[model samples]
Target: MKQWIFLVGAIISEVVATLSLKAGMDNSIFYIVVLIGYVLAFVFLTKALKSGMALGVAYGIWGACGVAMTAFLSHLIFNEPLTSIMVLGIVVIIAGVLMIELGSQAATRKEKGNV
Candidate 1:
């Protein structure tokens, strides 16, 4: 419950940090936000990992979701192109991440059953 929220927060912070990096490219002021956001992002990520979520699943979801969100944000904010192939790739990554999370959970459950 709270762990999921922390995960979500971490992802959002990562996205913000990336955006801030872009913004900081022109002005040094935004670098502060970028640094703070990155630190907070990792802090929340560590907390989420400690909250009993599978490492493989949590990291996979975090990475894939971050990539997807970054791509979408780049399109919206920077007017970056979004081709059909790119969209398909993002979707596939999302699906793969979900599969990894599910598989890890199933494996953990099975391991517990064995013990």
Candidate 2:
């Protein structure tokens, strides 16, 4: 539970950081947010790992969610393009992450059964 919370924080942070990186191109002050966001992202990710979340699952979720949210939000907030192809790519990323998560769960269950 705590690990999932931490992972969510990490994903949000990474997305914020990525978006800030783009916004910072106009106003340098956004760079501060970018730095803080990325740092906190890693910190939360570490907490998630320490809370017994598998690294592959944690990173897969973080990266995929971060990419999805960043792209969507960038389209809304920054007037960036959200073409159909990009949306498809995001969907594929989400599907890949889901598969990774399921595989990790099955592997964990198998290991526990073996033990």
Candidate 3:
């Protein structure tokens, strides 16, 4: 769906922007990427919202994915620590996001008289 695409764009944009922040620390030019990325991220997020994605579900997914991807990429790109405890925390965050998504779906279904 268009909404999902927009949401994914938002997520990827956010991740890139976040990573750029670290890169920006070493070089100021990356700050331009950071600014553009964040701007596009919000734009995509707004599009996703307008396309009928529930705010709770969209935001939850965005935040969780951002955290997970940022952590993994940071480890790969910056040699940042990716310890076991952090991995476990990422898993937990993902699980919680899943629950939020499921709950949102259930609520939508109920509203539609499907339950």
Task: Answer with 1 or 2, whichever has the higher TM-score.
Answer: 2
| Clashes within 3 Å, all models in order | 0, 0, 0
Candidate 2 local accuracy as lDDT?
Answer: 0.94
lDDT per residue for candidate 1 within 1-115, as digits (tens), equals: 8889889999999999998888887899999999999998999899998887777877888899998999999899878889999999999999999899878878887989952
What lDDT does model 3 reach?
0.97
Best by TM-score: 3
The per-residue C-alpha lDDT of model 1 at residue 70 equals: 91
Clashing pairs for model 2 are none
- Which stretches of candidate 1 lie above 4 Å from their native place? none
Tens digits of lDDT, candidate 2, 1-78: 999999999998889999999999999999999999999999999999999999989999998998899999999999
TM-scores for all candidates: the values are 0.92, 0.95, 0.98
Determine which window of 10 residues in candidate 3 has minimal summed lDDT: 100-109
Query: Tens-digit lDDT track for model 3 on 1-115?
Result: 9999999999999999999999999999999999999999999999999999999899999999999999999999999999999999999999999999999889889999999
Write down the lDDT of every candidate, Cα atoms only. 0.89, 0.94, 0.97
- Candidate RMSDs in Å, in order, are 1.8, 1.5, 0.6
Q: Using lDDT as the measure, name the better of candidate 2 and candidate 3.
A: 3
